[model samples]
Target chain A: MINIGVDLGGTTIKMALINEEGKMIDKWVIATNTIDNGKHIASEISKSILKKIRQFGLETSSVHGVGVGAPGFINLDTGFIYQAVNIGWKDYPFKAELEQLLGLPVIVDNDANMAALGEMWLGAGQGTRNLICVTLGTGVGAGIICDGKILHGVSGMAGEIGHITVIPRDGAACNCGKTGCLETVSSATGIRRMALDALDYIDSESILRTMFETKGDITAEDVFDCAERQDPLSSTVTEKAAYYLGYALGALAVTVNPEKIVIGGGVSHAGDALVKPLKKYFRHFSLPKIADSCSIDLAKLGNDAGVFGAAWLCMQK
Target chain B: MINIGVDLGGTTIKMALINEEGKMIDKWVIATNTIDNGKHIASEISKSILKKIRQFGLETSSVHGVGVGAPGFINLDTGFIYQAVNIGWKDYPFKAELEQLLGLPVIVDNDANMAALGEMWLGAGQGTRNLICVTLGTGVGAGIICDGKILHGVSGMAGEIGHITVIPRDGAACNCGKTGCLETVSSATGIRRMALDALDYIDSESILRTMFETKGDITAEDVFDCAERQDPLSSTVTEKAAYYLGYALGALAVTVNPEKIVIGGGVSHAGDALVKPLKKYFRHFSLPKIADSCSIDLAKLGNDAGVFGAAWLCMQK
Candidate 1:
């Protein structure tokens, strides 16, 4: 069956046609025009999807359904998006609007959750029923899958791993109106902030300081790159970030005891430099038994994970 | 339908016969004979159950099945107890042995998980599909119920909340071979230890000192009683313990986001003295969104939670 997956993001909308075996048959990317509070998003997506279907010479009857991953709090039962900040959509009837235009079944889930499901289907999760997929990008986010189902707590707010308290006292302020969140120390943004903070220290001779002087700022990538090159200052900053992230994951390990933890998004590109220390601290904090049963791996699907996960959502319905 | 729930512990074997609505129709308690490596436990339970069934004038058909809660690292699918240190059992086929002796189907699960399920069915959980029930006794234990099913991650160690590290550095040693675990500061054993440690401080005037001198050692109950009577030392210990427990729950709120958190066991008897401070700290540490959606309540089932939870296990099958 042909399933259409849509990864609706702020800057771009990624769409793909996936087969029954979860292989991508066709794909498309279009600039997201969030004009008018994203009022036209549904119509634009449907139009683009329909045109692509015709060009591919696939009959309408062959199409299974559409699955979408969008940012924000959602009513899973009703497919309603509540305050998706990046897309500027609030309380929009996303599922109904998309279904009305497409004339097919549709499923909507959080973008992070979609990524986790995608990884579970054919990525780092390797078909594990219990998994935690964390995206450490500009900010940190996580999707929890238990017993092969996305766990959406009371208000669709479960798996907000980034906001878990790590510092407890005198923590960096977060956009989520909290301090000491994992996002404030482990996200790419947090990593960059820590690097900048560390560079400001007296006589800290490092390439990161030179990078800051040249580029006016250092990125999470710059910090990881310097650490890989054995820059002392950069290594300290990366280890600190990994420490908190690892500790948080350890706490989560005891709570849910996932079979696998898939690390994704930008900061994950740091590769072994990130995973090594993260794994060490993760082992240090978690029970030996739990740590032994669980494996940590880099997310393999990359950007396409969202779309793949979105498509995987269709199978659940 | 009728189900027999068995709560197998080190000192006692609490059993209950319950109707379809989860109400205990009859109950009995017997000594847990740990002699002979507890090899005769299954037969002991089966014979007691048969005698009770006959006394109640019930036919074999009326007893749908038997569900048992045993301490140990269990294989849920096989119902095998890997090692129950207190029960002196190792690699015992609990379900098979019980089924053979009783001539009825048997389901076995971790004792802690059963308590959580029992609370979910008829206690503090109040029928919430997603809930966390923690038992703060000699050591801390937790049972996680997600979407109305017990969550046993990988190897039946999903809800090991007691092991989550709270101190992270230079904390107290734990029986789990960890340093500074939540159990080190939050269990009944932990509370007594802290109260004793605090009483050792110079120039401290408290009834606890008088009690400890006379009674040889203070119980967890003495700490709460003293704290209730406005003893400064005891109040500090209770609040400190509550702080760690609350912080752990805050982190868990972001992971599974249970609708309700049920605090039970010996420490829960402290009532408002324990919960009031725990709720304040829980709210302080958790994201406002998650903290608002979740409520903390005392476990209503008390000692009977195990039997009720064990019975709930039968219904799941």
Candidate 2:
């Protein structure tokens, strides 16, 4: 039997038909309709699923269940979304409504968690039962997999590693109303912020200064490009970002002691430029035993990680 | 059936006869014979177990197996001691040797892991499946229990929270060859060190100065006593120690998101004097949601936690 996986986001809704072995048989994406506070989302998802079933000439019985990776604090057992700031969802009975509309069992979890599960199942963390998957995008996010299971704490907020206070004093303010969070120094936005902050003190000969003068704003990509060329200012910014990220990972290494740490998201695309420095900081911050045991690697599945992980949720049940 | 639990430590060996319900039916202690490089330790343990069985008029067949909580990096599946620094054990076949000597199945794990398991089974973390148990004795040690199982990272070193870099720069040196670790500030030795350091900058009128002048050396207990009396120097020292500890715990709360944090060890005896200030620092450091969900409580089992946790290991198989 096959399973349906849904990667639900504020901008788009991506869906996939997955086989028992986690292979995606077919997939499609639809622009999200957030009209009327997303009241029609469940119906739209059901309609899409039915259209796909009819188009492929497959019976409903062929689909085992539907698993969704949603952006919010989800009640895994109840399928309730306590809050989703971007989607404007609050106390939404997501699972019950989706199950009713699709006439199939539905499972839902945090999107980052799904991405981690996806990596564990078919990406960088394959064959490792315990691991941590971190996404360094606009904000730093993480998902913890312990003994082949997602660790959902009492409130399904177990892997909020981004909010960890990396700089205890005089740190930048965070969106979460806190200061010195890992996200402040490690995320794509954070890297860009660091680059911008450095422009004032940077040497006039620096390429990053030239880029900032020409572009009005330097992105994390711009910072990486300049660093790759050995620009002192850009290299300093990247080094600091990598240090905070690696230090946070080191703290996690000693706490959960996962077999592997899978780094994902846009920032991780820097490849060796990011991981080489991260591994060094990780070793410096962790105990020798922990530093020697856990392997750090980049995520392989990218965006599809959510859908694959959603399908994994269906397979689990 | 009954299970035998051995809490092997540097100074003494504690043994317990436990029932299926996790209750300790009988218990005793013997001074650890670490002479001759600890070679005779296993045979001594077996002899003690045999003596207890005879004294209680119990049959050998009535005991299911033996569970040993040893101080070191233990290979849980193989019952091997990778390295126990205090006992001078290296690559010792702990389980096989003990099983052969006692004529029963044997299970082994790190002492801290056992203490955590013990607390989860019958102490402060009794009803919680996910929790972190920290011991703040001579050094800081931790045990992580996720979903009712001990989190033994790759090579069984998952819960080494002591070595997490709390002070990123200009922090004190730790025996682990790291700077600014939580143990360097929060452990018993760390607390005493802080107290001694405070003597230089402290006011001459402070009571701690008097105590130091009278005794020539102040213990961690002396610092706590002086703090209890609101002595300025001792209070400042305890506050700094508590802040570092709380900061480390806040990092763990965001990373692991355990339902509770059970603080064990000698320092925890300070009770509300320690917890009240620690809670304030934890709240200041963590995301509000995390600070609200994960509780910080004292460990209820104390030294007996190791023995109970060891018995829990035997019960698993």
lDDT agreement with native, every candidate: 0.91, 0.89
Q: What TM-score does the A-chain of candidate 1 achieve?
A: 0.99
Question: Which segments of candidate 2 are over 4 A away from where they belong?
Answer: none
Compared with the true structure, what per-residue lDDT tens digits does model 1 show for residues B194-247? 998898874577888889999999988999999999998889999999999989
Q: In model 2, what lDDT does residue B36 have?
A: 79
Model 1 clashing residue pairs (backbone): none
Off by over 4 Å in 1: none
Model 1 chain A worst lDDT window (10 residues): A199-208
In candidate 2 the C-alpha lDDT for residue A166 amounts to 95
TM-score of each: 0.99, 0.97
Tell how far residue A148 is off in model 2, in angstroms.
Answer: 1.5
lDDT of 2 at A265: 96
RMSD of each: 1.1, 1.5
